[model samples]
Target: MPLLPPWFHVRLTFGDGAVVDARAVVSEGRITIGDLSAGPPAPPDGHTAPADFAGPARHRARPSWPRGREGRRLVAEAYRAAQSEGRDPVLAVMRETGRSRRRSLRLVAAARDAGLLPPRHNRH
Candidate 1:
């Protein structure tokens, strides 16, 4: 198995030559999506400016947001399923989908906030 730095991003090539980014964990020699790999280090303070200021900057980059409603639904479903199984939804999400805790948390929170899961009173 190839060793990668926590901050390193990985792209996997399948047998058909199609490539996909590997997620948090790699199991059984298969590159799974949503692995908990480390993210890039935070930028120096000098690199950031006050939010009120508007101007062109040397380094212009923004994190990618989640996709359409379908993606959101998928995340919600995953969270609800995990919670119902008597596991930490976030941890189960990480194990099954390979997403980082941060990513899984976002999904869980979104589902909870949206009332996707049944009320606690309903669960025995």
Candidate 2:
């Protein structure tokens, strides 16, 4: 059977490189639309999108640290450097990554979770 043209067609491209095609059909003067995908569509080029990309396209911002294990390693190294230099670790991380104190703390926690840093003695 031949496919009939939709009454309306629209294409949407998201900031994270997701593309979606929407089509509406009009039958007996009633409009019908198809169900959308449960999740965002993959990039059109078949290449994997950057894992670091977060949030919506319009408000997208790059992360301060590198992605994955390398980022954790870097954070652990920064903490070690700060301790060696007798400077505050959080402040040192802030200087190195230009991230806020809270964000630096989170990064430090991630580094510790990655086994790059020794366990924290005090629980908060």
Candidate 3:
């Protein structure tokens, strides 16, 4: 006789703003599953920005912060290099970090302000 495992349920939210609910039942490593959606895809949460550039823009242009897989890899490499070389870690972390200058500067500045870097003394 084959033994049966328990059922598992999951809820997922997709990038396109769709929500899905699914369930699965397993028996001896073989599984059967079913899914059902509760409602139609929902629109993004907020009001859409005006398409026209006729009026002064209300928002300022801000550089996107690196947070994805590749970005995380770059950051890790930079940090490791900085640590091994005994340099200002953020400086090494941002040098050619593949991010915009503004973002790089902000990263370095934030690290410095947070006391991650040793205080530098002015020399004549």
Candidate 4:
């Protein structure tokens, strides 16, 4: 998946009495803004970010994923609730996080690995 630029909706007014409503896509240090009264901005189509943009020298690594035992506990709790309701545990995580299926599965697996969930048994 490609990293998307942040977007901001702006209404610019020039001294010449011209008003322009634009959506700005900001990536790196550059911004692209135009009359984008259209619907939502499109996915970042092949926009290449500089290598340094990913380097730790310039950018600090942010903790996007939940961390620590508490987080794992939460994931386990969600899984248990869904399983009790006869819902797909992975789907429950996906709905709660709005994350990809793979990521959600990883989260649930982590929770199980942390011993928050009972070990899976093969029930023939």
Candidate 5:
């Protein structure tokens, strides 16, 4: 058997100390690409992010809770989602828009009392 040309491998690096390895092949008018790995190659066991980015981000760019009226609206939406599924949900406020759990909880209660959720009926 004989091997052909048109295959290439290249390494790319970024100023931030990141790197990616690329492999490509073009044969008979068809092209194929291999896996691209970014940054330092992952360990055999698994891949991991820096400690500060290990899990859900709690970054300064976004505050945990919005202020005043906007915060109210954010929590209301979360509360609505929570009620629909018959349980509390992590709203954009909690996970993205950024609202404190305590604040979100209070706002949720307010929205509920304000008629976001249907009235409860006691059952025996």
Candidate 6:
């Protein structure tokens, strides 16, 4: 039996302020977003990702830290501490990780991707 294709739930916002919330399927080197599929996806054979994937939650390699998991945990803690202490969390992550600014940013990105950290607020 053939396995079902992966499904993604997408919310696309247009320049004209129109938003479309729809589902997509990935199959046979193609991505069919919303009602554009050539055909419906096959029934699940229990080998596909969750049907609600949003196409942005794919995992990547995790950078190693000095304290291992503890050091990784510190990224969150230090960021919070910096926020409460009125310091830059990015800088604090660098200081605590003894990592460069680029690496610190990568760690932060990973945190955000993992949903462990919320997206940063933008102030005008």
Compose the digit string of candidate 4's lDDT tens values, residues 3-116.
787689997665543456888887778888844652323225655445553345864444455678877887888889999999998898777766779988888888878889
Clash list (residue pairs), candidate 3 = none
User: After aligning candidate 3 to the native by TM-score, how far in Å is the CA of 28 from where it should be?
Assistant: 1.7
lDDT of 2: 0.78
Q: Count the backbone clashes (under 3 Å) in each candidate.
A: 8, 0, 0, 0, 4, 0
Report lDDT (Cα) of residue 113, candidate 3.
51
Better of 2 and 3 by TM-score: 2
Model 5 C-alpha lDDT per residue in residues 1-124, reported as the tens digit of each score: 8887666888887765568888888888886776676665343445664565336666557555665666666667765676578775645436645557875556666655666644456566
**TM, every model:** 0.35, 0.46, 0.29, 0.46, 0.39, 0.41
Q: Residue-wise lDDT of candidate 6 within 1-26, one digit each (tens)?
A: 98888798877665544456778898
Q: Which stretches of candidate 4 lie over 4 Å from their true place?
A: 1-65, 122-124
Top candidate when judged by lDDT against the true structure: 2
User: In candidate 4, which residue pairs clash?
Assistant: none
Model 2, residue 60: distance off in Å is 13
| Sort by TM-score, top down from the best | 2, 4, 6, 5, 1, 3
Error of 4 at 43 (Å): 25
* Winner on lDDT (1 vs 3): 3
Candidate 1's displacement at residue 80, Å, is: 2.1
- Whichever of 1 and 3 has more TM-score, that candidate is 1
Candidate 3 lDDT score relative to the true structure: 0.61
